[model samples]
Target: MAPQLDPGDLVVRAQRGEPRAVARLISLVENAGPQLRDVAAALAPHTGRAQVVGLTGSPGVGKSTSTSALVGALRKQGKRVGVLAVDPSSPFSGGALLGDRVRMQEHATDDGVFIRSMATRGHLGGLAWSTPQALRVLDAAGCDVVLIETVGVGQSEIDVVSLADTTIVLLAPGMGDGVQAAKAGILEIADVFVVNKADRDGADQTVRDLKYMISLGDRRSPDGAAWTPPILKTVAARGEGVEDVVAAIDSHRDWIDRSGERDRRRLQRAESEIQAITLEQVRARLGDVGGSAALPELAKRVVAGELDPYRAADELIAAVGSG
Candidate 1:
């Protein structure tokens, strides 16, 4: 028989930068292990210190390469980085199909960097269901910065904005991404835009298109302060123009801090997380009610027009609350 794991011991080792312990904690989160509540309680105090940056875009836009390059750049400045690369789930194994851990082999030996490839498991919004909890694990594991690279599921990939402190939208030239971005509503979420593969033809035109689109939108902070998203060009494969991208991120961070937008965003994020958990628990309680005769009895009453759905729903909620 396998031994039971201790959440407090695992958290202590993880905070000491033990990679195995960190990985174990993340695995526990991903699997929704029995000790999840205890682990979360143990990890709560050490979190909220890591700066989370999310990179997202359509496929073929080089998000992984750009993420790898950004990791290298951040490492140069002596930052401990953690990468949560959300990949499409494999049909057979239900694991990450395009494993970023393999693609980012350059940083495999770097102890300052920790990378994990997560399968989306058919979840929408281009991120795995466990991503936020996994992010908390990395944050509590002493990482200075955590980068979340989404699965590049275009049009439905905006959920990263809720989880990240800063969101970077990457685009490549000759892909019609500028107009597509506007249509897909990514222009509103991007704090920094990178026209990657700049050495290719039509790179300048792409930048111009992005700039024109930006001019059409209201790029203001909540406090009415003007904050324009910078359209920078980069050839991430060659590591060119990456430093400028880092500089832009730093500038955006400063702006959000000064404008009090960071607190607002984090508050919204926390509210969303809490709401999701409460809804999930309510759903579980409903499942329990369904197993009893209460749901069927209510359904019969509703079918016979003896009870209205609203009141039935209210009664069901009351039952759930009591249970």
Candidate 2:
């Protein structure tokens, strides 16, 4: 079959590392029309090559700048990088309110880097619904490292951890970020903790507090393996201390690889993505029901007190055949 929205050209161009083609492919993923199935099938073989890292934190923690710095660092190592800055969605428009591209303009002209901002769009974990698929697009387009920088919605940042091979939680001095991180359950999910703005008054104190907090709890890896989440400091504005953070991330990656935890985490992520996509398809299929009297009758009976909601829902499910 012919490709969607192309003279059979966009995916080919994207495979060649054309930024415009990559952006268009991501747009198709975000919109996710019927054509996405074709796109996915075509791109499947080229994916699974990129190392995915997630950067998340509360507001004012310098996630955007750190993301930019990471991109630069990775590029300096002769690797291609892609960034997805997930922004808060507007309630009225369901679109990104702030794109964060301004913070990353230093790499705008670099062909080795691709940066985009996405809207949370009311997704539960402060990430875009299409992020996983968008990630595959970046991976297929030849990014060695793909960074998913999520909205700074405190605890909901856990969603990023679920998707990433390595999750970095950024903190700042004087904000009680350590305590807030504990409250957000980040200590449970984070593979690395970053203290950005390290030149500030409470930088060392913040790092100390984080170390103490981790010491107070178990720093064991997810599968009873012995691995610790490192606490690193970064002054992202001056691009200070970011290389150490990157090195820490690389070390964690190496550890996970040696421990076989990387394969396990990727499998879990794939399972979750399958379940989510199935639910989405089921909901969409339900809306396309043409000759469905069981639904309307069940609703009427429930409203008239002829049947209970649970019973009506069961009948509706039976009628829909698990749609």
Candidate 3:
């Protein structure tokens, strides 16, 4: 077996580009043990240095292409970029295909850009459990901007909004309902919207629909500033409209800084980290008390109509709470 790694030692090795150490740190974050929590706490001050931008939309809407184009554009401007692509977990095997890297082959040889494909690993609240830690690693590794491409619009998609400083939602012109189907939480979270593949026939109509929907959401910034999310058209494959996207991102950054919402956003992210860590700690402790084993038995009993799930959960909580 590999020797057990001390958190500080792991951090040093990870900083030195040791792939094994980097992998181990990622595992620690995913597991979120007490030791890992301590590591995260220590690493917190080093985070928030990188701009985190989340790109999400319906599948096959060219999100990965857009991400590649954006990263390439940023690189041309001399900014180091990191791309984190979150792939959906397979329903049958619970493993991810992680094929986003294949779509972004242009960066395969670029030293200025780092790309990582992460599995959702059954995390329901939008990101993988280890995503925050992964972002911290990228930030410490000297990435000026980190682009997070989520699995797409679904129940967990809204989680990206809370993680990103500026969330961009992408849409293609010919999608069945166009912008009308995007009126829920997804539309509300976009700091900027991109009608990607503008070469398509209905691109103009799509942009108009998106603008109308955005108008329905609360436009006033929380800090009492006037900040309107702009809708940009893009043909990601041909590298069209990339400059506009970058400009919109810069504009949002400026708005955040000017309105003082940047500090508030940082505080909210810190609170989110605390909650995620606390829940992971509680779950870890529960695991030690046979809660994992007991849960399945209780679930079976409930399915058999021998016990109510609510009462069983109460009993389990009491048992673990006492232990």
Candidate 4:
């Protein structure tokens, strides 16, 4: 068996901006290690400080490039940054296929930046299953900002809006993203819209299309305050227009905080996190009940048409609760 880790020590080191400690803690979270609960408890007090910004778009929208440029901009302001790039999983090895760290090698040696690429590993909604816990690790590790780049899967990827303080949706000039964005209901979730590769043809029309769409949407906060998302053009490869994007993010953050939407959103995020954890625990309990001959008998009864699936599910929950 592996040696037990000292969660307190790790938490302390991570708060001091020790990358290895932060990475180790995130690894424990990803693997669902026995020490995870202890580590989370140790790090809880230091969290809730980092501003999480999520960048998501369909594939080939320069999300990685934009993320790297934004990191550079934030670092210029002397803020420590963390990036979690969620990549599609490789079918063969179940590892992050894109290895975004390689794409962001420019900041690989920067002490103020911590970049990690996590595989979706069959998890839906364009994120790794442990992303929230990993965000906590970075937040507690003294990062002023944490950027989450999703796997860029269409439609289902809107889950990023739940975790990010500000959500940026990127579109390219020729990708027909304006239509896709509407179909995906992304207009509702986006806090900032970026037209990347602005140097390309049709960039002007893309901007115009986005502007027209935004004009029709009711972009308001729960407090009845309006938040018109700023649409900007960028050539991320050249780092042009990134500063404007960053400014828009800062502006949206201020708006959310001032309107009390930040607190409301965080509360909702916590509720979702709690529900997910509770379900996972219940799932584990159901597994235990399944192994104890309960599941096989239920299956047999259902197969014989003596019991409906819904009744079997109710019985399974009761067995899990008792077990």
**lDDT leader:** 4
Clashes counted in candidate 4 amount to: 0
- For every candidate in turn, the CA RMSD to the true structure comes to 3.0, 4.0, 5.2, 3.4
Stretches off by above 4 angstroms in model 1 are 89-103, 122-128, 152-156
The residue-by-residue lDDT of candidate 2 on 156-224, one tens digit each, is: 445555788999999999999888888877777788999999888999999899889888887555667
Candidate numbers sorted by lDDT from highest down = 4, 1, 2, 3
Q: Model 4 segments beyond 4 Å from truth? A: 1-3, 89-103, 122-128, 154-156, 298-312
Cα lDDT tens digits, model 4, 142-173, are 99999988744553445554689999999999
Q: Tens-digit lDDT track for model 1 on 27-61?
A: 88877768889988988998898888988887778
Candidate lDDT (C-alpha), each = 0.82, 0.77, 0.74, 0.83
After aligning candidate 2 to the native by TM-score, how far in Å is the CA of 66 from where it should be?
Answer: 1.1
Cand. 1 Cα-lDDT: 0.82
Q: After superposition, how far is residue 159 of candidate 2 from its true place, in Å?
A: 1.9
Which runs in model 3 stand beyond 4 Å of their true positions? 1-6, 13-24, 31-35, 89-103, 122-128, 177-181, 286-323
Evaluate residue 203 in candidate 1 and report its C-alpha lDDT on the 0 to 100 scale: 95
lDDT of 3 at 138: 71
What is the TM-score of each predicted model, taking all chains together?
0.92, 0.87, 0.79, 0.89
